[model samples]
Target: MTAPGNQAVTMNSQGTAMSAGPQPAASAGSLRSALRLWRLLRVRDAGRSDPQRLTGVLAVVAFAVTTAVLLLVLGGFGAFQQRAEAGGPYSDEGFYVVLAGTASVLLLVPLITLGGAAARLSMARRDERLAALRLAGATTSQVSVMTVLDATVQALAGAFIGTAGVFALIPLVLPVTFQNRPFTYAELVPEWWVFALTVTGVALVSMLSAGASLRKVAITPLGVAARHTPNPLHWSRVVPLVLFAACFAVLVHYGLAGIVVLVAVLAGGFALLNLLGPWVMSLVGRLSARRARSVGTLIAARRIIDDPRGAWRSVGGVALCTFIAGLTAAAAMFDSVGSDDPIVADLSTGGLLTLTIAGLLAAVSTGVMQAGGIIDQRTQYRALHLAGTDLTVMHAARLRQTAIPLLAAVLIATAAALVFMLPALGFGLLSSVPLLIQFLLSVVAVCLLVLAGNLASARVVRTVLA
Candidate 1:
């Protein structure tokens, strides 16, 4: 019944169906394309055309170096704690070491915040490239994968550099004694597994952060072109502040039994501050915007109101440093009176070390955040420059943006430190001029350091303009 040609066509169709059953050729092509994409990402030219990409890489490197240093410092503290726990001449100091370790660990927040800022800044800069990729037929998953891979590469490079930094720092750290004994190089240097873990941790953090940043844009390619306005902060933000106050009250009521409790409470309080800071900043911004008497002030206030979270990220670390400085000052006064106590002397030293480390890290964080901000806003900055806006005015606005929040942070942290210290030291402790001066000088120094860091970004602005 069928024509001869029809039979030939039926046989061809059956062969075609058999050949299409497994799709081996299509799968292999996909695998090959993925490999090619990976190779392209590994190529230097992939990042060379984009200056922001280079800046992001540098930020990651800086973050890794700082993280490595922090981990080493923490390792040294752990060694001291271990020695104290062994029950010898240092047994009395074990609690102090434990407290110090906890404080050091708490410092990780600023570092993590700085890393997040960097990742966000990096993502902001890549919006155009991402959109282009999407337009060119890359699926959202492909774009997300590419971003994560980019972050992972940068993080891996940074971690390796950071490891070298750790080795270099060990010699410098070996001479510093804690608990009446210098740390052995071995004690300061973490184990091989720890180093490996650090590298892995950094890479994972970078990958997750980059991936999270893409969530806003990955679903809809057009989302990359649209800016989402952050909602106004609500009353719920006050809960953290209230919780912190309660914790402090409990500690004040318990007194000496509260030292161990105080450490945990202090950590919680700082974390709460992180939550409350942006809200407070938003409130301040609104107030300042209403009272603004100049163009610079108006611009700065509006900027803060628009992005309070970003503003806080640049100064939160300094606020913590200010608190540490205040606490150290109070501790030093106690040490002066209790000269006979070796434990008090050791605490004073540890507190000063903590202040120094915190301040240094804060300075670095401020600088990195500021620079990243400049890079992220370069287009606007350039447009403003072309519009004949005075560079000095822009500079002043930038300073004001940092200054308002920073002043508030220092005041809040210092007040809180005083309140906490008052239960331990009577009102008479406030009359210690030497300790007060020392604290004031330390706070001023840290603020100046942060200011310098922020100002350093002006160079980036200039570079961008050129």
Candidate 2:
């Protein structure tokens, strides 16, 4: 019916048309596949912007710092030991290293973890990003879990890095040899179990420290911003303080208390700062507000009352740091005043008082630094002023609020000494004053350092506020 050439051309044209028509559908299918891949990758990207990032970053940095400190401590001790065996002039130098290193490590870890947790909570309370998580259907528990997880991951990584770094750096700092040959640095190669335990312990502490803040998130008024408004300090601080006071009283009366008694007393004092410090600030805040001629003081007072927890938290850090420094100073003083000295012999005591004070103070210093964030929250305070608070009154409220924690910490340190020494040493308590005095001076020095840090923080905040 048709010529062969025409038929062939017709068939070829039909095939070309069919292929072209399906090309668009194929391309669209490919596009959809690409889009699916992107969607799948989104989960991975989501974690980067999480509130937990702060915790993670902190953990990493802390790990590095801890590792460095550990290395310095170990290396110093090892070299001291080596030098002593060589009949060097500093034969007893190894003792200092052991005392300092053990004290530094044992005291530092818990304090750092506690402080880090408190600071992180403060940040979360202030940050809108955390609020956004809530809006996105994340429950308080989910947020808290994520935070802990991030801390855990970072802590684990950090511990590993820190241990390895310490092992590596120790050799550089102090070349300890064995039998005229360098000791093989094995077994000390970043113990996985140590990293696991350290990181886990730190994360748990941090999470627990954040408990109050997390509760706030869970119970925050619906539709209100998750930003904490001024409120009474949480009651967790009060009960513990009461219990501590009771234990301390018992210790004072008994004069034969053990380590358990000392721990209870110290913990109670720490609790009192959180509980009583906030109440004191709230009272001052109210008084200041009443006397205000303008709205600024009232607003500031309101802010102080509204966020008593924050103030208490910051004080905790200060207290902890002061306590640690005081302890360190006390120990050094004791060492300086040799036990065999006639004056020391007349005192009728051993190393227990000095060591106890140092250890307790170290714990207190950790708590105080956690509360340092309050000083960093000046902008938020400024916002209160802008919202109609008088600057002078507000500043007073802030100052008073801050003073409560510092004072509490100092008092607690004194109380800790009283409770522990009175029981353990009896009449020997009188002899403790000289060492306690040294501790007080040390605390003052550390407070000066904290104030300097605060001033620097204020300057930065002022610039940012401006």
Candidate 3:
């Protein structure tokens, strides 16, 4: 309960002096101590450690991207609402409202996932220092609180930058017309409360993710270590896929009964893809390893086989984005049919917009996850370099690790999406050159974006090895 200045040499709130006899400290008292410790080490750690600096930069960048995108998506909601109000209760503005809502739902999960990736990366980069505190007598809750506090600060900075990002992006988007007219900046802006809520949500997700990650690890005097192996992923993951297929079939068998049903099916199916992704990843890894012809491929395959969940985590956003592309590209294809209706014309623009935004989400999150993966295995990478492993081979292995799951996930998701749409579009859907072009363009763009993400982390490998 005493102030930090009371002791000859002040210790943290826990009174844990790293001595054999350490006194217990209250949680509230730990805040000053944690802040003091953080300030003392921040400069030294940033200056001395490559990973420390990189983690901070990545965390801020990720939070900023997440926030900016959240605002952009929310703007669509607000724009549609404003348009609806201007129509005096008798316009097809409601139709656009439904489209905007659906697109927002598709993008929301990936945005939060990106924030978690940022938190996970930032939290991990500090494990050594945190474990040192644990050794010096900090309790689990204390270390966790410190971790959350660290993430909260990073999140706040990121959100501020992200708001700025939205302003910066507004001019670029101003030329794009919806409802036959371009949007003013004011029209694109959401309600004032939306900004506050989004910033708070981003911070909360970061803190929660950082605190939760600590629970999975055992930080002791010895080192930062994970506990026993997690229970293996179960076959029950397939349940989602089955449920998705059944729902899709029902929507197809019946008719265009309701917008609510369509959104529910789409959202449910998207959620299920995440569950099915890891299991599918494991299956792909096992099969590819058996047929591997090169050392790089074998290593990559082995990695996926060992931790398929982590493998999926790296590429899940990209896969989900691909599904979005598959679902929306049909609307764009309809434009090629030369429909005169303004709504039909707008569908093309909306579809392309959805694909572009989803692609951005995939790219940013993939880069962060890839960087974090490399940092997590820096020691292993160093050992491989020290051994006879060639630089080319290491690079090859890293590329293969991402390339394999990304290819499988995209192809399967696209195929599933196309199949679900068959009840509506029929064989014509598959045969349309415009749809084919849209899909191909999306695939190429996604591949390029994913490759860019992988390339961004290539420097991180060298940093880790050094």
Give the candidate number with the greatest lDDT: 3
Model 2 TM-score? Answer: 0.54
Reference-based lDDT, each prediction: 0.71, 0.45, 0.76
Model 1 / residue 199 / CA error / Å: 1.3
Candidate 3 residue-wise lDDT at 457: 81
Cα deviation of 182 in candidate 1 (Å)? 2.7
Instruction: Evaluate residue 321 in candidate 3 and report its C-alpha lDDT on the 0 to 100 scale.
Output: 70
The runs of at least 3 residues in candidate 3 whose Cα sits more than 4 Å from the true structure, single-residue gaps closed, are 1-17, 27-29, 47-50, 88-90, 127-129, 217-228
Candidate 1: list runs displaced more than 4 Å.
1-50, 255-257
Question: What are the per-model C-alpha RMSD values against the true structure?
Answer: 7.9, 13.8, 4.0
Query: Residue 111 of candidate 1: its Cα lDDT?
Result: 66
Superposed on all Cα atoms, model 1 deviates from the true structure by an RMSD in Å of 7.9
Which ranking of candidates, highest TM-score first? 3, 1, 2
Give per-residue CA lDDT, model 2, range 236-297, as digits (tens). Answer: 65566666657666766776455444444455455554456666555655676687665544
CA error at residue 431 for candidate 2, angstroms? 8.0
TM-score of model 1 relative to the true fold?
0.87
Cα lDDT, model 2, residue 238 = 57
